[model samples]
Target chain A: MALKLPFLQVDVFTNTPFKGNPVAVINCMNIDESLLSDKQLQAIANWTNLSETTFLFKPTTDGCDYKLRIFTPMCELPFAGHPTIGSCKAFLQFTGQKTAKSLKQECKSGIVNLTISSEGKISFKAPRADIEEIPQDVINEYRKILQIDCVAAPKLLDVGPIWVVYLTSDAESCYNANPDFAQMAIINNKYGHGGIILAGKKPGSSQDYEMRAFVPADGVQEDPVCGSGSIALIRYLQDLHNFTETTEVNITQGGRLTRQGEIFCQIKGNADGAFSYISGGNATIVIEGSINI
Target chain B: MALKLPFLQVDVFTNTPFKGNPVAVINCMNIDESLLSDKQLQAIANWTNLSETTFLFKPTTDGCDYKLRIFTPMCELPFAGHPTIGSCKAFLQFTGQKTAKSLKQECKSGIVNLTISSEGKISFKAPRADIEEIPQDVINEYRKILQIDCVAAPKLLDVGPIWVVYLTSDAESCYNANPDFAQMAIINNKYGHGGIILAGKKPGSSQDYEMRAFVPADGVQEDPVCGSGSIALIRYLQDLHNFTETTEVNITQGGRLTRQGEIFCQIKGNADGAFSYISGGNATIVIEGSINI
Candidate 1:
């Protein structure tokens, strides 16, 4: 069983070379259960040492679009934003599996819409997800670890499979504070919920608003531009603002790691107040090369 | 010119088996200049996939106790808390180099005390460091990524050569945030100081307080019990609360990681408000195996 074909190493979060997080985007595989062991995938991802690496595979049971399984240096995850978006973008750029402007990315969470704009920004319309209302004591537990005073009750905001909203009084507080990174990694693995979706408003300008989504549970400490988190944060903000149309906002991520990049996102909600359309600026393909190894 | 002995893997941060973060500790080399390259060291550390790794060797020159180098999966690091504490602990446990009750750990920053107790707890007393004051604009920038509000002013807190102090307002606004781990690893390699230390008064507790640290810069999203952070945090609280003599305190970390551990620390200050001594609890060693590769 010799397996040697081709692989591409692409930068997922940034367009720059060797700057943003590098992701090894492989070609799509069949739904065969024996494609690659999770351990092997993790080793490869670890070897690459990218924030995330995706293994695009054909769906075992095809209902809509294609399937992708994402892995990090450590473990496998149920759902992820950058891996999803990056995989879709890489698939289109490398394998040319994107037959349409919009693609239905199938995962354990179900089908998600991946829209590739002419500007190259990929937009994802996440499915209707459930949110949770965590207990004050539990929230207190988080507060103790983060070393901040209580702001407001954190509402659970789920886009696809699930999510818990960890609310800050505003985005400024989130940006300003320093956390115990080691402790966060431990807790993230303990309480599993995709991760905590953080919400906050920027004072000053309309473009000054800030949002940071945490998902240590999913093996990611933080994401540059979390696509699913965008779904959750936008939903939470829209519900607060009481809006139906899209809210053009700037998503700035990758403060602690890598360089900072902004994604221009538009939040479109439905009449029922559920999340509807999440359109964003186009994405630029940074790396596209085959690896002999 | 094949090498005889290869570098080995070592665990750090956890006492129990298969828990806490694992860091690969590699012995430093003195190969023919042609045999070793900086790229090779980074590649070896990257291959380990641990958040952080260490390379130790006697310095080519004299005057220093011993020359120690650290590397993340991505790049080299000037100084880090866990590796410093863990590496020194490992050095004493296995190599038994520093036979004294306490030894000074020489690094880029200077010398810090690495003390081993009969109880087996390794207390590394970092040098008296300083905390820098942070401005509102800096807080604003962090808010974009952290989604936090209410920050305290910044101050510089140092241990040995490394020094930093975080200023954050409320804790509840942001808690248990998980960043994109890969992005953090890359960021930490390029820029020094991997994590941010944030803290607040523990709500509903008498003497206890709350805090978490973020380190996207160090390839680690959060650390459970940071020795330096513990030192800085205790020192900061002493300054904030004006505590004198020996201050016995319990700090909680990694509620996000689910590997919740308490750091029992004692902050010893001067009669006239000068910093004195820092002592803390013990850690158990869980893993002692080899990597087959």
Candidate 2:
């Protein structure tokens, strides 16, 4: 007899189908972990061929509702934003845990908390982050690749996953620019970061800013919508531009890639001290079924 | 209630589940053609995010058993080899048509006849092709990109799909070569061909020849097992190297990428006149389920 593994294909960062990044979520709580080897997990991820596929298991650690294992087509990730949101939605819906006010997820990064509302809105407390300076020559190389004149001093920020943040005054420039991906991949590999996130304030919309992430090193030229990138960008803004402790901003990303994803962000506390960034978005379950594999 | 569509995930060109290229096949014969718009088809293909997804429908053309439509994550392809094999296997198994000796498929590329054996071996006759001389400057560019010393006078072969064929004496060199993809993409775009195919005779294995295809412009760096490429290569050898009409050889590809797919090829008739090249391989059905798309 074939084993029926419950699966969900969720589109994250947007409520609409085919408009956001899609992640395959599998519930492996009932199965023995030893049965599914690392090679099998990698093969499942490769079958999906998506940016990431997540497997959910019962938490083995305290203070966590569930454990999440994220895998890209090529390798596994400590944690990823969209997969987090997608997996959370699938878990809540599948286990009938949506009534809970909040949930804790234990991943390779560590324990992360998410707050849920009555209306199904989910927001995550950004993981602890660190900031570092990037090399000037590398910054020049990025400027050339992104086809931008200048940027507000690129910074290497680590929020679970590392990202090189490039702040620009004009978001349209980043949205419209077609960077040399081949060259960008070289730079990304050299910097040893996830990718470069270019951010700027939105022109007229209620959304505070727009951002785009280019991750050529990962073979993804441009990320459609990046939850982790958004959180780190806000942290960078708080430190460089001195954002208020109670600041709330809406971010629009994936415009260049036609995904046009929206992420709601809220920051609490000052940059001089510890701060928590909350990133929230809607996800649509595009596919639901039992996968024999 | 959600409508469940019969679906199959098949690994093409190899019998192993995870080794060869995987394509998702959906049987849409029961569904109304008007109900499934082009946008919906593209959306479904995008959701799968595979190299190719195929939809099977009843043939509108006479003498054709079925009609197949192929789509990549980015766009639809008029013709593709792996998808053809994958779709055929799925259709035959799902429709209980396996007892048939042969099958005819109608697609955007025209009618394709496939011969199936009692042992489940499937072979396709190579399409008509025309060979032309390649430019000297382009040959030099290919030599630089392939990191090769020299190649037999390059030939531009139009076998349904146009391919720039490079005949090198060193099969190992072609198998191990890692050309600069960024530059190769530029060269492919400049040449306006499907991709460059490098072919040479393997040393020890009965699989007399080894080949590799680089299709950077199509965003696929290397094709795991290219049926059409193998056909064109045999044609080139028959004319250039004076191979006999009954010459049959087995070929391996995608070694650098670790796919290592095998393809058997046989050429009939002379290059001065009409010829038929038969390409055959094994396919394994990896996943079967009803997908609600």
Candidate 3:
């Protein structure tokens, strides 16, 4: 006998279908007796071939509505931003929970709070990032590999996933700049970094900046649109630009890949110091079906 | 209004689910108007993120039962072996064509004939390959990059997709061999080849050989199991071993990736000279659903 499980393919970071990063969402909440093992989950993720696949389960802890497990094609993640937002939308649609304005999700990284806006957008407060300055020599090596003129010193941001970030001179440079991914992978592996992000200001454009992320270590030469990478960029701005007041920032990524992935970010300053929030419009369920195992 | 299309995710080259290369098959035969443009098909393939995605349509030419279009995440392919077999299984299952023993498929590469065995395995006669010997210097460079001892001279086999192939000392070497994919990509791009294959004899094992394929140029560091690569290996054996009689060869790939992908090859010698056929067991449909566009 085959066990049929509900599955969804959701495009995240953009409401328009096929314009943003896609995540596979498997609803395991209905399966009461047989929970899928880690190996089975990994295999399903691998089969989907998506950057991330998330499994939704009934919450085990108090005050949480659901529990989520995120997995990439290669490995499982403690938490991932796009998967969180995408899976939340999928859960709501699957269970017809349209009236819920907010929800708590329990995962390996702890509980994450999500707020649904009047426009149906989803926002999650980013985990506090630990910052580290890149050494001058390493920065020089990166400059050589990326072949770009940096406007500011580079930094490493660890917000669950580590990103080595660079602020380039302008948006055109971000569009034109191509780095040696093999060398970048070597450096990432050497420093145990998750990926690298290049961002440049686009003052005149609709978006505040243009961002490109390369994660060769993760077997993705270029991520179409990266949610965690966007959060890391926000942290970099807060650290360098002195974001003392509540401010909203708009970012556009995946331009070179011919994808328009829009990310909305907010920085809030309070007595507890500055915090970042990553928000995106509603996810579009491109494929809705079931998988048999 | 959204248009809903049938979609199936099929695992090819193996009867067991999640043990072989997976292809996404979209059935477009029912759509009578507003045919999907190349851009839309490409977008769906990119969204799937699978190594290959195929669309099935009504036959455009006479004597053809169905038309197929194959696309990778990045680009379209004129022909691909796994997608052919996988899509055939999907089309049959979708249309409930249980009594058919053979079928003709029309594609950009022209017509291909597929035969179904009594046991339900699918086999396709491989296109004739044009072989070229590798230069000694280039072979040395590849030796350095792959860090393996070759038992025979390397060759480039072009059977629709070009494969730079090598015969290694033994099966263990094939399992242990790791090449610099970046360098391999550079070489492949320079030579305009599709990918590289490494095969080693496993005389005592159930299979005749173990094969590993690396296609960094195609953005795949390692293909779990490659159907075209298996055909190229059979061609190499025929060229070297003078296989004048009909012979069956069994190959196992994806062992290092913890997947067991078995390929069955047959070499037939006749008045028209030697020809190769690639066959595999029935494909397993892992996911069946509908996609809205």
Candidate 4:
């Protein structure tokens, strides 16, 4: 028997098409669960070959609107930023529910809240992180890889994925820095995560900071516009730079790799209490069709 | 204007639906050149996220049947193995030309000859390689990376894409060898290519050897079933061991990363003169649709 799964290729974080990060959203609401296996889901993800391809299914939780399983070509992710936003956009469009204000998405990471505006802009509250100190060995490795001595101490921040955050004084250096990926992967593997975010103040621009995310551990060298990375950066800023509850920041990423993307985020609450990060972005649907599997 | 491009996702080098390598083929024969640019082509490739996506166009060469442009999520390739075979299968099926015995494909690497049989097995002559000696520094790096003191001296073989070939005495070691991708990428960049292949003798099976191809430089950590890689292996075997002309060898690859795939090949002509390596495999069409982009 053949199954027709609705597929959407959505570009998230930018209003322009082909300018931001792209994700493949497969809606399997009507398809039988028996037809799709973990291997099959992984196969579909591998077929799309995207950084993340999310499969949407009916949520088992009482308050959750839908459940999303995100997969890279290699493995499954508990939660991902662009896939969450992209899947929300796709679910709204596919279900013809245009006026919904908020959505609770169920994933391996748990149900997360997503707010949608009438203008089609989507935002999700970033999960709180378990902050930790960067190991000295990791610091020494990055120092040699980045060729910089005058930099903030590296902090390992875990929101969903662990991101080793490095703050550079020079945005230009942040843009130009080429960390040896082999060494970077070693550090990432040592921590059992797949990413590192380098952020620096990008003064005098529309965006507040310039960032680049490298996830060689996950087979993605550089993420164009990372939503989760943005959240981690916001959390890092709150701890180090003292961002306020109402502080809204615009960050630009993926410039060096030429995908030039912008991410808008707001940090809420204080450092002592429950801090929530709201990441907002625009998504453009590039392909709408049914995938036969 | 809405453009309709014929799309086919074919699994090459295997007869199964989800195994082997999957390539998305976009037939742009009827679409005007103005409707698509290099950027659009890249966007489509990125959308598919497959190891490679191919665009089929009218051949610029006089005797060639068609021209193919191959793209990964990151960049375009002059020519690729699975795409060549998969595109041939898609084009033959789409154009209702199953009776044809042979086809000439034109790509940036120039025209290549492909043969098809009534049994539906597809084979193409592998391009000759420009062989070079392995640098001592690179060999040392791999020695440390693989954690093995004994490995055959690496040979840089440039077919369509350059592949660094390393032979191991133990097939288990070949399967278990995990080199640092970042270091591999550095070596690839230093050599201006994006692949490293590990090959070793298989004790007893239809396959003579076990191989794995890693192209992290192209964002592919491990290629499931690599056709170009098979050709390079054939060349390596002929040189390292005296596999004679008319030697038919079956090889299995991608066992470690779990997508166990097989490739069949034959070495033609004498070792001294022009030698052609023919790579043969099966393909299954998984998706057929008209894409509007």
List model 1 lDDT by residue over A225-282, tens digit each. Answer: 5566666766666655666565677766555444454555676656776556463433
Evaluated with TM-score, which candidate comes out highest? 3
How do the residues B196-240 of candidate 4 rate in per-residue lDDT, one tens digit apiece?
888877777534878889887666667888998888888876776
**Candidate closest to the true structure, highest lDDT:** 3
In model 4, residue pairs whose N, Cα or C atoms come closer than 3 Å (at least 3 residues apart or on different chains), thus clashing, are A49-B49, A182-B182
The two-chain DockQ for each candidate, comma-separated, is 0.03, 0.39, 0.73, 0.35
lDDT of 1 by residue, B1-293 (tens): 32332233333344542233445554443434345467665754553446676766655445444556778767787666667756666565456554456756666655666666665556656566555554566545444455444455544466532323454543453354433545444433443543566665566664464567666554345665565677777777676677756777676665555444456567766678676546444443322322211
Q: Model 2, A68-160: lDDT tens per residue?
A: 999998889887888899999989867977578899999998898988767776788877767888888878888888777655788899987
For model 2, the docking class works out as acceptable
- What digit string (tens of lDDT, one per residue) describes model 2 on residues B1-293? 34568878888778766667788898888876666778777877876778889999879999998899999877887777778888989888888885888899898888888888787867887656678888898888988987876557888887766788887776777777778877888988987888888887776654387888878898777777787788778778776766544777788876665575778778777557656777888888776666665
TM for candidate 1 is 0.49
Score residue A6 of candidate 2 by CA lDDT.
Answer: 80
Candidate 3 residue lDDT tens string, A17-84: 78888999989898852467788889878877899999999899999999999998789999888899
Off by over 4 Å in 3: A32-34, A205-207, A270-276, B32-34, B205-207, B270-276
Q: After superposition, how far is residue A215 of candidate 4 from its true place, in Å?
A: 2.5
Candidate 2, chain A: TM-score against the reference: 0.94
Q: Report each candidate's C-alpha RMSD, comma-separated, in the order given.
A: 15.4, 3.2, 2.1, 4.0
> Which candidate number has the best DockQ?
3
Clashes of 1: 85
Chain B TM-score (each prediction, in order): 0.72, 0.93, 0.95, 0.92
Alpha carbon lDDT of each predicted model: 0.57, 0.80, 0.85, 0.80
